[model samples]
Target: MTQRLLSFGLGYSARALARRLLAQGWTIHGTTRDAEKAEALAREGVQPLLWGQDDIEPILAQSTHILISAGPDEAGDPVLNAHGALIREHAVRLRWAGYLSTTGVYGDHAGGWVDEETPLAPSTRRGQLRQEAEAAWQAVPGLPLHIFRLAGIYGPGRGPFAKVRRGTARRIIKPGQVFSRIHVEDIAQVLAASIAQPDPGAVYNLCDDDPAPPEEVIAYAAELLGLPVPPAVDFDAAEMTPMARSFYAESKRVRNDRIKRDLGVALVYPDYRAGLDALAQDEAGE
Candidate 1:
């Protein structure tokens, strides 16, 4: 049987995984809201179906794997709200299911370390929705669900280098405010590992080995770009939108032990510095 994966939303990380699996001969299909994005995905050889513009039941029936990268809204998870019953009915066809959640679900660990077993205490609305979505997905009977709580995701085009180059980077100094992050490629690897080793109802925190201050990452990116590092701005003094400010409210070091131990996975870029350096190399190569 040809391996087929149907992703709810094939955004950055999901598309990366799709590219990887596509090389290995897996058929890919996903949903997107925008017509332009759907066309782009089609160009990349991914079967793109517009949400509400097409029926997903047949795709769901044929999928051997399913990945939900769509975040929940005020009402609830968009995917669950739209297709929860269908997923439950097609559970037998799905060899594996994954929910891409955020480490923000474990809010404000006071710069302390948190693992998969850590209790969820989300301080932000986004985190709350993710936690609720995770629970809702787990409740779907017979779904081979694997939950991945990802940290701040950064990669080639999405890294701090772009901000530094564009002169929009800010070195916000918030004492004791540290954040865990992961390279998007590593996220794809972790997802692939989980698919290979099917574990139903398993939760894993996906982050790099290092948890450092955001300012340090910005500074590192500047150094790599051979540009002057942005001046420091105190968190309280920095002018930021409510959503950006909310990001600074949480301080925690996320651990990826479960992925390492259970999946036998090794991260390519284990810290921001390494990740930045790799991105720089890729830029230079390009």
Candidate 2:
């Protein structure tokens, strides 16, 4: 039987996974709010449907696996808010469901380590929203839910190279601050592993082994590009957007043993060094 996946939000990470599945002969149907992107996805071999413009029930019924990457607003999860009842009613062929969440739900751990078993104490509103979204999805009766609390996602076009190239890179130094990040490829791999294993109600932390300071990552990108490393700016003194400032409020090293222990996923890029090296190589090639 051909595997069919319905990606509720065909954004960056979802597109990465969709490309992999498409290569392996799986049929992919993705929903996007943008018309041009829908056309672009269609050209790239994914069947695209517009949000609110197209009926999601037929797609939900046909999907063997469902992945929700759409974020929640103040109103709540757009996918759940719009199609919770329809999903419970029409997901007849669905064997697996995955929710792409964030490790921010763990909030600030004072630069301490947190595993999957750690209780959530979100420090930010965004984190609190994710916590709420996780519960909302888990509450859906008959829905096979797997929540992946992803770390700082960095890969390909979304890496530090762009900021460095634009001369907008800043090394914000915060004492004892460390962050866990994962390559987009690893995120896809972990999701695929979970889909293959099919464990409902499982929660996995998707992150790399090494958790380092944000300044170090920026410096490494500069070294790879042979550019002058951006000067360090103290976090307290740095002029930043409210969103960027909010990100700096949390400091925690996330653990990724569950994905390995449960799904047997071997991460492709285990550290920022390996991930950055690959990105640098790709940049050189381009």
Candidate 3:
């Protein structure tokens, strides 16, 4: 009775989750856009499939549980574009499906706390599209949809420290501006817990303990690199790309009490400090 776990758009957090599940002897299928990545995924024991191919129906048809990490591509996600008529053909067999969404859906909470019950008010096209994708999946009959609203995601190779070392760290200051975040490992754990015991149509906000201005993270990264902190720039003066600018448009402090109370999760990286310290020390070989 080994459960087969399949992930679409196996990137970032999903990559780690797929690895963990594979280690636990669960059969895994991960999707990627390129053949080389597909080969790499295969090395991890994942059956990798590319989207926009006729082959998807067979793959989607076999997955007992589907975790969508890809979100909607520029061309709109094939998962949403195609819908579940193909999946529905074998609906009785699919048990659980999870969609990784963003807290951006809550949109500009002005540092007010929010949780699963908060109504979505997205401020960006990405967030709007995510909501659309969620609705598309949920509309299918018998599809057990669980949405995880993720905060700023960081882990080993993808956090502020990496930006610091690469000389791209920017200390953008906006007084009282803060954001909640989560470690990729914690995301994997939350997904694991949800799969262990799912609540259909449940929405979980996945964020860690502290909500602090981005400047602090950047400065800490500078300290970890033993370099002077990057120069601060006011949000108004910073030259940001549309994609990056879009991130600053929303403001919120997300709550994770529900996940702790309900999923019984005691986060290993409770805050940025804990996670960053570990990364800094690991770099120093201490």
Candidate 4:
């Protein structure tokens, strides 16, 4: 049987996974809100379906796997709100279902470690929504749900090199504030591995082995670009949007042992240095 995947939101991370699956002859149907992005997806060989504008029921029926990257709103997960019933009806046919969640759902661990077994106690509204969304998806009976709690995602055009080159990168300093992050390509491989070995109701934390302070990452990026390290600014004194400030509200080192031990997945970029190196090399090559 031909494998078909229907992705709720074909954003950066999901698109990376779609690229891999598409190369393997998998049919990819992804949803996007923008017409231009729909054209972009089509250019990448993804069948683009506009959310809320296109009928997804038929697509859902034929999908052997589904990936939900759509974020939750105040009410709840948008996908579940609109197609929870449809997904429930077609649950039995789905070979695998993946939900992209965040490590924030584990809440602040005071720079401590949190694994998949950690009890969820989200500190922010965004984290709370993701936790609730995870529960809502797990509530759907017979759904082969797999939850991936991703740490900070960085790769390709999303890295800090741009800011470093533009001379606007700031080394935001908050005492003991450390974060775990994953390369986009690493996320893709983990998802592909999980698909190869389906484990329903499984939860995995997607992050690198190294969890370092935010300032250190900025400094490294500057060094990679051969630019002077950005000036350090105290977190309290720095002027930032509420959304950016909210990120500093939590500090945790998310564990990614499950993805390695369970799926036998090896991350291509194991740490920020390696990831940044590859990104720099890619940029240089381009």
lDDT by residue (100-206, candidate 1, tens digit) is 99999998988998998888999999999999999999999899999999999999679787779889989999999999999999999999999999999899999
Please give the distance, in angstroms, between residue 114's alpha carbon in candidate 3 and its true position after superposition.
Answer: 1.1
Give the TM-score ranking, best first: 4, 1, 2, 3
On residues 1-286, what C-alpha lDDT tens digit does candidate 2 reach at each position? 9899999999989998998899999999999999999999999999999999999887777789999999998999999889888887865457999999999999899899999999999999999999999999988887888999999999988989889888999999999999999999999998988888898989999999999999999999999999999999999999999999999999999989999999998989999999999999987898
Report the lDDT tens digits of candidate 4 across residue range 177-256: 99999999999999999999999999999999999999999999999889999999999999999999999999999888
Candidates arranged by lDDT, highest first: 4, 1, 2, 3
Q: Output the worst ten-in-a-row residue range by lDDT, candidate 4.
A: 252-261
Over 21-108, each residue of candidate 3 has an lDDT whose tens digit, in order, gives: 8888888877777889888888878888876652776666667888888778566666666645766675557788888988888888
As a whole number from 0 to 100, the lDDT of residue 100 in candidate 3 is 93
Model 2 lDDT at residue 39: 90
Best by lDDT: 4
If candidate 3 were superposed on the true structure by all CA atoms, what would the RMSD be?
1.8
Better of 1 and 2 by lDDT: 1
Q: Which residue pairs clash within candidate 2?
A: none
lDDT score of residue 27 within candidate 3: 88
Give RMSD (Å) of candidate 1 vs. truth: 0.8
| TM-score against native, each model | 0.99, 0.98, 0.94, 0.99
The reply for model 4, stretches above 4 Å from the true place, is none
Scored by lDDT, model 1 comes in at 0.93
Each model's total of backbone clashes:
0, 0, 0, 0
